[model samples]
Every structure is written in structure tokens, then in C-alpha cells.
Target: MTDEKNSLYGGSQSSDAKSIDIYDENLHLAEKQKKIFLAICGVFISELNGKEFDVYMNTKTYTNVPKNANNIKEFGQINFESKDDFSARLFDRLQKTTHPHQFARISSMLKKMCSKMTSYSMTNSPTKLFYELSLEQRAAAVAKWSTSQKASIRQFYRTISYVARTAFWLNPYGIYPAIGYPGPDPEKNGPRFKGRTFPEYEFIKITEDTNDLEFDVVIIGSGAGGSVAAARNSVLVIEKGHHYHQSQLTLREKDGYEKLYELGGGMLSEDSSMTVLAGSNFGGGTTVSWSTSVEPSHFVREEWANDYGLIHFMDDDFVDSIKNIKNRLGVSSSNVIHNENNKILIEGCKKLGAPVATVSQNSASKLHECGWCGFGCRYGEKQGAAMTYLKDAKDYDVKFIQDCFVKRVIIENNKAVGVEATINNGDKKFKVNAKKVIVACGALHSPALLLRSGLKDKNIGKNLYTNPMAAVYGIFPNKEVKAYSGTIQSAVCDAKENVDGEYHGVKIVVGSCHPAMMSTSFPWKSPLQHKQFMLQYNHIVPLLIIARDRDPGQIKIDSKGLPKLDYKLSPHDAESVIAGILTSLKILVAAGATKIGTCQTEVEEFEIVGENSLNDPKFLQYLEKVKKVGVSNGQACLGSIYQMGTCRMGSDKAKSVVNPFGETWDVKNLYVADSSVFPTSAGASPMITTMSIGFYVANCILSEKEFVKKRQSAMLGTPNSTFTDNTNADKRSSRRRSLLSSFGSKRFSMSN
Candidate 1:
């Protein structure tokens, strides 16, 4: 009867049910512990994911887990013994003993008993139990808990770990702690190189000893000055800088652009007041220039010859060379195809009775589409010397040695024999042997190089001048202009004159600077301004004007060839800036702009009904008064060319480094072919002037009786590789020289 009853109900014969198995106690305890851990993880994950419950458990994707409450009960039943044991252990490990009455009553009796036992075990050996878990197990538990709760515990851990890794990567503090220390001296006893400090093999180690670096000419910089020398020599030319291919230029290249500034060594002033931005690249200023090519003023040319005493070098010969350079570089009148934005500027200037003429540029085929001329031309269209003169020089045996940084000009017996340099490839240093050495690095850098080379002239870095530049913005109503899609500068208004004894220089047309670049230059509170302006990019037009200043700034070089600039604005310069702002605003208003904003002033709205507000007598009188005040009272003013007369060329050795022919007056073979050789700032764009001088200087070197004789002999019976098969070369070689010679003779005869 008992067996029949047990079978009918499916109950065990003993009726007390199964007892816990002692042999499987440890395994059962581990299983229960895992389940508790899983429960904790589920709660955490729910928080992390911002979910209400353990959705993963409920989802059908997890094959091994129960999906709902019905299945959970069944699953818990099979695992009930282990679960009870874990609960009892956990309860006993707690310092505070009593559970709430509700929990105590609802829990199974076995579970309550196991929880007490677990609590006692934890109290006895909590540390040992934690140590028993492997790292993988801890990580898995943490991950599962975080995922289940979605509360982000794992993310916190990851963030801390990442910070630790980064600290290791960039830390330099742990470098040399064990050396026997003298006192606390900073140099030798200070520190040694830490682990992985500098990048691997980025620079070629140079020393005072290496095979005598021999070249036809050792060009100090690879910019406008040196590249032109290379073109003139038509021989193996070596530029002491990196060769950046057109394809390599991108937005990323601008990050390290300032480092490559080894060209000018850089410029600064003695007063320690200002910094100048000049180009120091393979293409020189052309690489970062605005492509605003303007001819030097006629007065400037005359002053260069009659006043500065460069009489022999500044005649018709110089003028003809400039014309030739313009032709070679393809500097032509910018046209409407440059874009419609340019037309608006022209039209605006014309409407204001200040007609704007098309500015000349070196770019080809409207390829300045990037509108980033100052960042190096991504397209080869900008006729920088790199694309024209330097390109031709390379074809004519001019070997370009990129990444060769000129440390100093080598002086042996007070004659410029060669240059000392840091090579980009190896540890060995070298010296270039040259009959003539030219310093074309630039205004700031040329002086630094001279100082580093130990050529101490008290006036070496003095008499600095810069063509102060500034921009003005106009907001037009109901106007949409895609400003960035066209040329950087298309037209310019030369109508500006001295309003009150203070010169405002020439007013020129301009387009918008790139958004990213604008952010970098004017980064404060400008991002929000950028977003606002972005919506009005089409309606916005900018005007850039170059101003001539008598503000005598100077660049001084430290021992390390770094420049220190001292800038003090002459009263005239400050007034010029104000005039520039007022003039740009006037033009925009004339063009029917609805509003105007300046980098230096607050925005203002214009009423069409009150058009006379622009020409109010009070306003004009205020501008005239303000034009006499120097520097910004509330206007934005930026200067582009901080040119110095360091290493300047003159007739007297006592006053200048170079003579009228650009040769160092004291040093026989040393030459300066760059702006360093300029007698003055040229009071206009110096691109053509500098290149023309470079060509003339190089021609003087090659036209020496010895070099010319050799060239004539080399060409006699052999197909001269130097001469091009094209007709332009024939004209350049045959007709150009004769015309220039006749002009030079006429000028000399007149002077006599």
C-alpha cells in the first residue's frame, strides 16, 4: 500500500525528501556563489543600461539561461541546495545579524540556515576567499554585472586604466634618479633621456667633421631667395630644408608647419615686444603668402637707388629682371573666372567711386580652389618659386637636399667659404664648400643665422619694418556668398591715401580665411561666432589691405639662433590701422551691405533709410581724429611682414653687410640674396622685388669672367643641357640680356 501510494503521487518512499550530499558540498557552494555573483551583475547592468530589469536574461538569445519567472522557479529548484548554502554563508558573514521579518519568513528554511553559515565563513576568511579568485574570473564577474545592470562600472575601470597607460606613455619625470649626484645642478646632474623620449631617427645627426660639403653654391634657405639662386645658377643647387611635395600637403601638415621654420632661423625684435609670421618652406613665402602680388611703388624704386645708394644694382637691369621673373612665374591679371566673389568686391569698389583693379597672381587655371594659400598650395597652380624657378633649377642639375638645416655660415679667414649644417639623415655633420654663400632665409632668420655664425654687427638685426595687414567683415542682408570656394584675393582698391598726414597705405580686396584656420587664429569665443557666420558665409565679404609703416621694429637673435622681436607702433601705424578698418567698412556699405562687424569692434546694423549715416559729418571727423591715434583703441590690426634690415646691402662696409652687388662688403665671398639685403621694406609686396634681386645676384656670380668662360667652353661642341629647346629660352638668353645691358649702360652714362 505504501509503494502504491508513493508511485501514485510521484513522491519518494522516505517522505522526508533528499538530504544534502557532503561529498558534493564544495562544488555546490561554488555554484551557489556564482549564482549570487550573477545576481549582483544583473542588478548592476540594469543600472548601467538604464533598463528596469535583466533584459538579457529575458531575451531568447541566451540559450543556457531561463527566460521568464516560470522557468526561473524550475531552474532554482534544481539548484536549490547550493543556493540555500550560499545564502546561509552570506548571512553569517554579515556583522549585523537580523534580516527584516518579511525576508526571514519568505525565504525557505534551508536557505536561511545556509545564509547564516555563509556569513560565519566570510567573517573567518574574507581575505583568503577574495585571493582565491583569478583575474579572469574577477573581470568576468565585473563585466557581467555591469552589462546586466548597465550602470557603467566597467567603463569607470577602463577610464582609470587608460589614464595610467597614457601617463606611462608621456611621462619624463622618472629619467635619471640613480646617478651619483653632485649638488643640484640642472644640466649634467639634472636628468638623462627617459625611455622612448624622442621619435626614432627623425633627424640626421650633424657634427663639425664630415667630408667637406662641396657644392656650386650653398643656399641658406630653400624659400624665395635660395630657390631663385638655384634657378640662376642652373647647376646643382642644394637647399638646406625639407622638400615637401605638392601631394603631401594637407590639413594635417599645418600642425608642424611652425617647426620647419628653421628657415629665418626666425625674426624678433630687441625690445621683446612682438612676433612676426614669415614663410620658411621649400617655396618660401609663396607657400604661406596671400598670393597678393603687387609691383613696388615707383617712389620705392627710386629711393632704393638714389636714397639707399644701391645705385649700381637698382637701375633698368633690376627692373628688367623683375619683369622677367613675373613672366617666368606666370604672374598675370586675375580674371572673373577666379570667382564671382571677387566680382562683388570689384563692383563694390567701383560703386564707391574707388575703382578696384584686378590683382596679379602666380596661380594657374584657377587651381587655388583650396583657398588656403598660406598653408602651402595643395595644387601646383600657385606659381610659387617651387613650381617655376626651383622646378627649372632641379632640371638643370640643381640637387635639392631637403631637411638640411643651416646652423651657421662657415667663416674661414673672414671669408664666407661654406655653411655648417644639421643633416636630416645621419649623425655625421658636414660643411659645404662654396666660392659664394648667400643668406636668403628671411628677415627674422637671416639675422639669427649671422649671429649664430659669429658675425657680430651692431646693426645686424635693426631697422625692421612690416607691411601691417588687417581684415574687415561685412554682413549683408539677404546675401549668400560662398566665400571659400574662390581665390584668396582677387581684386584690390588702391584708392587709399593719407587722410591726415597719416598714411593708410593701399586698400586691397580679400576673401574669407578658412574656418579651421580662423579658429586657430582667433580661437576665443569664435567657434560660436563661426557657426553664426557660417550661415552668412555667402553674404560676408572681407577686405585685406597692406599698410606701409615707419614703425621701426627690430629682430634680435639669441645664442641659439632664435629671434626676439621688439615692436613699438609708431603713431602713424596705429592711425593707419584705424583707417584700414574705416575704409573697408565704407566699401562694404557702398556695396549695399546691411550690417558690418569687425574683429576689433562690435557689430552694427545699417539702415537703408538712413544711408547718410555712413557719411555723417561727425563720423568723418571722428575717423580723421582716430586716424592719428596709433594701435587699436577698439579695432583689430594684424601685421604680415615684419621685415628687418639685418644683413642689409649698402655701399659702405661700415654701414652694411653687403654691397650694392649683394656681396658682403667685408667678407669677399659671402652674399645675401634675400630681404636681408633689402635697403628698406620696399613699401609694397616684396615677392617680385626679392625674386628679382635673387636672379640679379645669381647672374652677377655666374657672369664672372671665369664662370662665363667655362660655360661657353662647355657649350661649344656639346649639346648644352643648360639651354632649353623651347623658344622662350632663346629669347631669355639672347634678347633679354642685351636689352638689360643697354638699359644699364644708359643709366650709368646718365649718372656719370
Candidate 2:
């Protein structure tokens, strides 16, 4: 029966036109408005369990009213109000009705209302009111976050954007246009390469046919760690994801905007669990993340140093390694992108009597204030790893094979051998025979890869950390400034540390506008309001704060061995969020914000405790309530870069998978050089940290001849020891002598 039903509706049948119901509550809408609304509502209901929707008058109660001129204009007014209220009214009415068709009708009405609202005049309209409302919302969210747990506004924005993005992606149709960002551009709405053709790999000189041979060492994952490791070892790096060079960014055009998913095919892990971040393409997170590199604070380093006896790794050795890595990767403060938005942040910091410092970035252009960093600078400007390390690795004879996904490392007798990978484009399998292997597949996927390899240490996929972030929008009464015209990031605040148990990271300046992101961040109930806000986009200066989450999550492998991250926001994590939010509120207010708002429901009124109301019991209660939730709520979105310390580095094999040297204790020729080897989550972004680890791990392996010699000797002892040669012994002896000469005497090195 199901097949027959599908067949009946199959084969390009046009959808039937929606029929109108005169007695229905939606009958009062104009014929044109009704048709549009019905179509939209049908789409929404069809996607959302066929729930009914019903149109009603602007009054709080969902009742039909006479079609007077006032009522008609009132429809616009109701739609112009905050979409939160508008959606609530619309859904409340629909949920009350049992009519199946009602769902379609209500959905359609909402669509029409959204279109009308967005169409308002930018010069003078209710849309401008929405920005004020949004500020009010953010202020409230921040106030609650602050006094409650010292969370900053940065956390609020990150959490809200994440949750809303997730919910919207799952059900695009159910999304009320007024509550979310604008839809994609009509011109660039479809797939860019859906039907486009290209030359086959068979025709390319650097094809499988040409590089059919295996490598002595194979490195999987072309990220910070993997790329550096491959460079250090001159190993062949096989990246299993699409490769996009900085030069390929077509978003240089004024109208150029990257499609969200295609920006890098970002994975939104299971919503029921923690957010685990993983990159499936070349350069990993560096390709698409903000170019903010930070070193771990002395306190954090000392903790790790003391706990793991990694004093050498934490101090002089680590600093020397970073300095070398920096030079290799071209980390310099030569070019800075500073602009009005950046100046504003600095001025605001000064206004608040706080010191503002220059935020170091990796952009080669260093324009001080260009807003194109996140969107891939049109000019070959920003020196992302793709333009820096990857190119350098290639220069150093490190071959990179894109689109070759390594499935698992070939392990036998607890020693690494080679790797088995699938050509993602085809079912054809390939193997790279490597005497040694390095796992640089990042935190989220590295654990999954290990789990798939059948090495089950209980903590192989736990202790995930992300510098969860938030932002506060400073709403000025006038539209004199254009925030988006400046640099993507500018000034930074160094006042970050955990007071008690709560933690936050570096605070930086932020500025950008692609319309859609604006809509998500701005509070607009109507399309008209959105248009007006766009006119005042210059007036919105957002302060960005990234916080280190005390909450850690675990990366679980699904039945298919794919990663499933379960994030549990610890009580302390929530406290950090609340604290972050409150700090933002104070900053915005100090920046001369007339009104404030937030994303928290409990602290709505407390956000604007007036001078007279400062000691109000209601305000105090609101603050207390937010504190309670911030300290307890575990479901909030807090982590980013979704770092998983599943296979952490430690001194003992029983407690951790890797040793202090980043080599797996259980497996001899296997090493982890990604964020997965981090013994503790850094209170900052992990790009530089991962890169340092890669360098350390690779150098450690390179300095040793015993690991490979031991492996070679063991392989000789085994029955399947293939490709035996006396040359390996010669190489081993030479390497041993080189190591002895290199570290033989500090007096010899110092004398030189």
C-alpha cells in the first residue's frame, strides 16, 4: 500500500493549489495575503508533523476580528512586534485547534506576516525598533550571565546562535523568518557544483595512477598537527577531505557570501549530547576559524607541568618550540588590520578604565581592520595555515593527497605498520605501507579513528573542551557608525581568569555583516524592521568574549564508528557562562547603551535594573535565578573547536593513551599529534598548542633510532617481516650516532 501510494504521488506531479476556507479564522486576510500565508504554512506544517496553524487577530487571544482598515493595519503592527511574541501567539492558536488543515493555514499566515514586516521602509519604520529590542534582549542575557556566574555576553550569543542554528537547520520550513536570519540570496540559492563537471582524476598528472606507490611514513589529516608532523618527517600526508586554497575564495566580490554548510561542511554533532567539532577537509579548523592564536597562561602551564612532570615541555622547551614553529609558520605582527570597529573597542575599553591591547593575528596583509578574515579575504591577505604551513610543507617535499580517508592504522603485535584508506570518490581501497604513523585527525575524529582501530582505553574519547564564546551588541541611539566596515577583529582584553572556579578566555573586538548573520543576531519581527536595522548596521558594535569552559564532554563512536559527542556542561561551566553574560551587560551599559536585553528568560527585567531599582527584590531574585540555572544547566551550548582529550598524553599508560612524548604507550610506532594528546584543555584556542605538540612529537620521534630499530628488530623476529634490508640497520646506526652527537653534551652546544 505504501509503495502504491508513493507511486500515485510520484513522477513530477504538481502540488495542488491551496483551497481557501471562508469560515476559517484566516478568511479575514486579503486574498493575496491568504494565498501566500497558506502556501508558507503548508510548507512549515508538512515539515513539522502536520501540526495545524490558525490565523487570528493581533489581540493576545487567538480570535477572529472584523476586517476593518484598523484591523488590516493592525496585522502589520502585530507582525512588527518581536517575532518571539508573534510566533507564540500564532502557535498558541494553532495548538488549540484540532483541524489538520489549520496547521497549513497558520503557517501560511506567518509567512505573509514575515514578508510584510521585512518590507518596511529603512528610512523610517518599526524595523529600527527591533534593534533596540534585540539590545534589550542581549543586555538581559548578559546581566543574568554576569551576576549569576560571571559569564560574559559572549557566551550568550554563542549559545543562542548555536542552538538556533541547530534548530533551524533541522527544520528550515518551521523557522519563522522574523525570528531568524534572512534566507539565502535568490541568485546564489542552489548548489554551486551540483551539475558542473570537471576533469577526472584519471586525466590529471598527479593522479592515483602516478602516485600508486606507498610511503615510508604516512600521516593522516592535514591540520596543524598533521601538516607540521608531515613536514618534520618528510612523510606523505593524505587528507581525506576537499582541499580549498585561500586563493579559491570567490567571496571577494561585494555580494559574495559563503553558503553556511559549504563554508566547510561543518558537522553539527548529535543535539542530545555535547557539540563535538571536527573538520573533514584540508587545513582542518584553521581553514575556517578565526585567526586567533594564544598561548596557555603560566598558571595553566604550571598545573600541567606539576601534574605530569612535564616541566621541560611546559617552559623553556615549549617556548623554544613555539618560537621555532612560529618562525616556520611565519607568525609575525608585521601586518595588522585595524579599523574603526577596532578603535571603538579600544575607546570603549579606555572608557571603562580597562587596558586594551593589540590582538596578534596571522594575516599577512595586517591591514589592522579588514572585516574579511572569517569569510576568507578576497585579497591573498590572511595567512591562514593553508597559505603558510601547508605551502611550506609542500615546499619541504611533504606530499599531500587530498580525498584519501584513512580508515584505520594497520596494527599488529602492538606495533604500527601501515594504513588502510578509502578513496572517498570511489569504493576502491588503498593501503600505504608506513614503518611509522602519526594521527593528526584532530580531537573529535582522532578518538573515533582510534576507537575504530580497536584500541579501547576507557578514556579514549572523553574530556572535550571548547572556548565557548559570547558577544554583546552595543545599541546606540544614533546610526553614525558602520561597524562592519572595519577589521574582522581588533582590540583584545587580557583580563581573563577564573575567580573561584569560573573561567573565561581572552576578549576581542568583532565586526562583520553578511545580512543573514545580522538577522540572526538582531531582533527583528518583521522584514521591514530588518531592512531598517541594516541601515543602522554601522551603529552596532559587538564585543566578543571567548570563555574557557570547565565543562568537558566525551566523543562517543556511533554504531558505524562515526563520532558522537556528548557535551555535559558542568555546574562550573554554567557559572562561567552567567558570569560572561553579566560582564557583557556591564560593558554595553558602560558603552552608553540606552536599553539592554538578553537571551535568558529568567533575567529579562533584571537586565535593566534602573538606579532606583538596583536593590529591588525582583531584580535580586532574577539574578539569583540565573545563577541557579547557570550553575546547574548542562544542556547549554558552551564548547567550540569541540576538543576531545579522549586519548590524553600522560606519564602512565593506565591513565592515558599517550606518553609525555605523545607516543601511544600501547602501540610502538603510533603517535598522536593533535589536540587529542592535550593532557588538559587549554583555556584558549588550541591551534598553536596543537602545532607545538606536532612539532614536539615529530622531533621526539626523529631524535630516536630505538623506536624504529626496535620495530625493525621485532619485525625481523616476526614471520611476516617483509622488505628486510641491511640498509635499515645502517640508517639506524647513523641515526643513533646523530642523536648522540646532537644531545651528547650541553657543554658542546653551549660552547658552540
Candidate 3:
């Protein structure tokens, strides 16, 4: 073995010798061995036919044998001669047993024994018999042990074949075993409430008799930015979508997509080259995101400051703003536990001498690692906008109106006064009057709203950025790695820095293996071939490559005033993606993966097998083929979660939509507070950076004495002319007369 392999396996010979002695001294191995022996005996008993055997099997004791399989006495009266006869029957029945779950359990136990023996051999040099064998080979050798060992190792081969058959029978689509998140439970957990503590409106009946509502400040979109801004000020938040409490979320992919995601989870770019995943619910992306809380990179900050003229990004106050947001969200690595999926990436990166780091998350406690943030954390442990800032805003008596879609900002003389909106998609229009209006509707919709509102800024919808991502899968034979069992995206490999070149900033992170997601991403050749891959689902490891592209895209409004993304992958960025895939493949090989596959469409089920494939010349040839076919044809299944820069922030009004403080350059009292104002791609996950920008904008608004003074003055009726109802009184003359009478009565009562 090479020195590197030795280090990876454990340590040098002399060091291993000492380690072996210590391990032997602490041997609880005998107990484990006894348990395995009993488990085998239990399996034999399960095949026996007798009243006693039936009674014992019905007790469900055999199910626990994988932990502690019992001796013959535990099964009751059966002699040695009978045992030998039963063993013969078991050998015969093993060939015909239709119980796939039972056979799977037996196979798993035998594999564990093999792994234990391999570890023992690796530590104790004198017993290095199976130390170099692959996991599959080791498992095969386990079956050759003596009959006295209690396990029927010979039947294991049949069980393996049965698993393949059963896998096909179970999944027709060749999907991974479906693991579901906890669904909404109204009886047990009550409503989601999200962050709202104050009263909220979901159904509003605005008739002619009803007067227009007035507020000191009106905020559109109840996402991360809107919620934070609302907390410090008494604002009325108008959300186009409805709120779903913890109990309201169905936790199924189809339901979540339809209810919580943008465009029913099928939002694509104008060219159909990328699928954009953005939230359109109460708390927006925070409610559905993976909870990765990466701070803004220094390179990105410096670039924005020096190149884009957003100098405030480098200020100490801005740094403090980021720190405050981190503290509020409890962003830290302390609660993160690297599961098998993440551990594989860490180990592989270490073996290949690549930079790796633990990802900080917004988990409230270590005990709250449920691996279901994509479906909304059931435990409310994720400190998203709904749980933190929006909750705080509710305490300040901030009102909220759900399902109230704002059509346009009510701009009078180039200044935002309020907004005009429809309630519950109804025809009855309502006008909300306020001193200022803030748009926090995310990157895609923010610019579209500006365009629909008749803003003439040339840069309103330009400079869109997306962190394009692709995933690679590694299958390790005979290893059961349940990738869906722990926290999603717990670690990252910094392959961008390791590669020698500029514009190659790629972050390779662990990806989710949820059944629906995996089925779509894993490349398929035919139904049978796909089923074969799904059978190895438990052994699959996925690595997601997020490439930071320098080239920018644009977001334009369609004829219906909806956002349309126009992005074409640049050659340099495409090459960077391919580079990331190669590095990911090398890491997988190093980590003992037996086969590798890419999500690229034109790759045509190409796979690299064998431990030595990393050193094989064909490996390079395969990668070259991937670069030619996948990158050139844009065949890689690409998606983006980190969307930004549509309404970019800068110092120049002619070049950008929003200023460094998040206020629009073209419209007064109208500010933006989302990823829309990001000047460029934040070379990392943009959650914390986006939240930090929100805090900075909120602070700027709070410090604006003139705006605050105007808001106070408007509330006290100093700007009576600003509150325009614009309702057609002729259609409802009687209702209008009644409203006028009420207004006259109110004026008389006030004068008295």
C-alpha cells in the first residue's frame, strides 16, 4: 500500500501494531460475534415448521436478532438431528424464499460481519487475510465459514439475487426508496403560525361602502427581507401567496411544489436551459431552503466595492450587520453533524488534498437535525424569516394580509405613496395608502413588478446571476449508506481554489437523495437499466457542483407582465462545470466507489468502474467525452437555488436599479431588500449575505429621519391628498351615499 493509502486506512505498521494491541485489550468483539451467531440461528428458526416455532416467530423476537440473535434454547424444543434436517430444508427454501425484506436483513447482517472482520484484519497484521478485499468480495467470503458459525453463508448468494428481483418488483420507475418528511399535524402541533403573532387577513371584502385602508408604511412580499424590515417598523405586509402553518404543509413533493414553490416548481428560463427554484410562500425561500448560511466571500465583497462602486459592502458597519444577522439566525457549525453522505465528501477531499469545510446552518439546536428542511422543518428548529424576524415583527403589532397580490405601486409624482392590489384574486380592488412602499419580492418578481408599475429605469431587470449546479453519483457496492438519514448539505469541498485558473470557482457539496429528486437527476438509459441503478439506492453518494459564473444574464417582462429569464451558459463557465465534475469523480474513486455516473443527459449512461479507474487512461477519455457531449450540448441537468442580481445595487443610477442602501434610484421611498439587489454572484450560498443586506437596508431606512418624519406626518393627516380611493362611485351610488354619510357623521363627532 502507498503511504497515502496507509494514512487513509489508519496509520503506519508500527503505529497500527500499538493500535491493534489497544483495540484487542478493549475487545467487546466477542459479544458482537455472539449476537451474529444467534441472529443466524434465529433465521434458521424462522424457516422451521412447528407449533413452538410458530408461537416464537409470532412473538416478533426474531426481528431483534440483527442486534442479538439468540441460541437454540430460545426457540424451544428441537434436537440436533431435527436441526440438521431443518438446516437441509432451510437450504432448499433459501432458493424459493419470496420474503425480500427478511432476506435483505440477513444479507445486511452478513455484510456487517465481513466489515468487522476486515477492520480486525487491518488492525492486526498477523490476521491480514481479508484486509485488501473489496466489500463485495469480503461479504462473499463470509459465506464460506463453518456450519458451527450458525450463519447459513451459502444462502447469501441466493438472497443477493432475490434483492435485485424484489427491487424491480417494488419500483417500476426505478426510483430510490421513498423517504417522506413529517406532514402537517394540526391536532398535535396546531397551525404553523410561522412568524405571525398579530392578526392577519386572508379574505377581504372591499365593497364601495368600505373605505380604503391606510398605514404608515406598506411592504410587499413577506419573505426574508420584508419580514425583517417590518419588525422595526409598524408596516402592513401584503403577500401575494397564502400562509401555511407547520400542520398545513403536506410534506409531499407534489404538494410542496404546488403550494410553496414558484410557478408550481416548474419555473424555467426563457431558453429552458435552467430550472429556477425559488419560493413563493409566506416566508418565501427561507421556509423551503436547505438552511446553508454562508457569509459573503471577501473576493465577492471586494469586487462589488471596487468594481461595482458599492463601497458600503466593505465598511465595518456592514460587517457588523452580517454578524448581527448571523447571531439572530444562530448560524454556526456547532449543531451540524456530518452524516455518511457528507463524511464521504470530507474523506475523499482529504484523500485528494482538496480544501473542505463544515457548512454552518441556521439550526436552533443540535438535537434538531431532522434532514427535512426542504419540506419545512417540522420542529421549528430552523430560524428562517418566519420563525425569527417575522415573529418579532408580529410582536410589534405589524399587520399582514395574505393572498393579497399587489398589481402596482401607487406612485404619485415619481414617489411611492402606497400600492393597488386585489384580494384573493377577486375583482374588488383595494387601495392601501402609506408614506413609503418597499418591494421585497425576490429577484425574479422584483424587477417584473417594477416594470409593471411603469418604472422606466433601463437597468431594472438586467445583470441576473444564478449559481448553476449539477450533481454526480457514486455507487459503493455492498456498502449501505442511507444518504437520506441525516442533515442535507453539511459539508463542502472548495475545488475552485484547488484548480489552477481564474473563473473556475466551483463548490462541490453533498446533495439530497430524496426519491422524487433522485429519480429526476439520475441519468436513465432504459427501464431495466434504471431499475438496476435504483436497487443500489442505499449505496449511492451524491455530490453537487455549484459553479460561480462571471457572465451575467437578464430578466425581462413578458406581454402578460410576468418575468422571463434569459440566460445562456458561457463557454468558460461550462468548462468550469466540467472541471468540477472531474474533480468530483476523482474524489468518489478515492472514497471506494465502484461505479460513477453523471446527471448529464447526453452522457448516455457512461460509467467508470474498478478501484484503479482513476489511474486508467480511459478515465481521461471518458471525461473528454463528457466535456464534449455534456457541456457543448448543454445536456447536464442544471438547476439554480442561488438567484441574484436582477435588480442590481450600485452607485450609478444609469447602470443599476437600486442604490447601495437598497433604495431604488428611479422611485423615491421605494426600496428593495432581497437577492435582487446583489451586485454579482456571491461565490457561496447567499442566505446569510442576503439576510445581511436586508438588515443593512432596514438600518438605512430607520436612520432616514426625513422619510420617518414624512411617514409620521402622513399618519396624522398632514398629507390628506395622498390617500386616493379611486373607486367608481356611480356603480354603487347607494353604498357611496352611505359611506359619505358615515364620513360626515365621523367629522361631526370629531368636531363635537
Output the number of the TM-score-best candidate. Answer: 3
Residues 43-135, candidate 3, lDDT per residue (tens digit)? 211223355345543432212112222332232332212333332323222322222233344545444555546435222323433434433
TM-score of structure candidate 1: 0.61
Using lDDT as the measure, what is the rank order of every candidate, best first? 3, 2, 1
| Model 1 CA deviation exceeding 4 Å by range | 1-210, 234-240, 251-275, 312-314, 334-341, 364-370, 424-428, 497-504, 516-538, 601-609, 616-637, 641-644, 705-752
Prediction 2 TM-score vs. true:
0.64
Instruction: Give the TM-score of each candidate.
Output: 0.61, 0.64, 0.68
lDDT of 2 by residue, 90-175 (tens): 22222221122323433443343444364232112344321323333323332233233323222322333333333223223323
Estimate, for each residue in 61-112, the C-alpha lDDT of model 1 and write its tens digit.
2222223444332321221112334333322211011112211221322132
lDDT of 3: 0.61
Cand. 1 Cα-lDDT: 0.49
- In model 3, the Cα lDDT at residue 719 comes to 13
**Root-mean-square deviation of Cα positions for candidate 3 versus the true structure, in angstroms:** 22.0
Q: On TM-score, who's better, 2 or 3?
A: 3
Per-model clash counts, in order, read 58, 66, 4
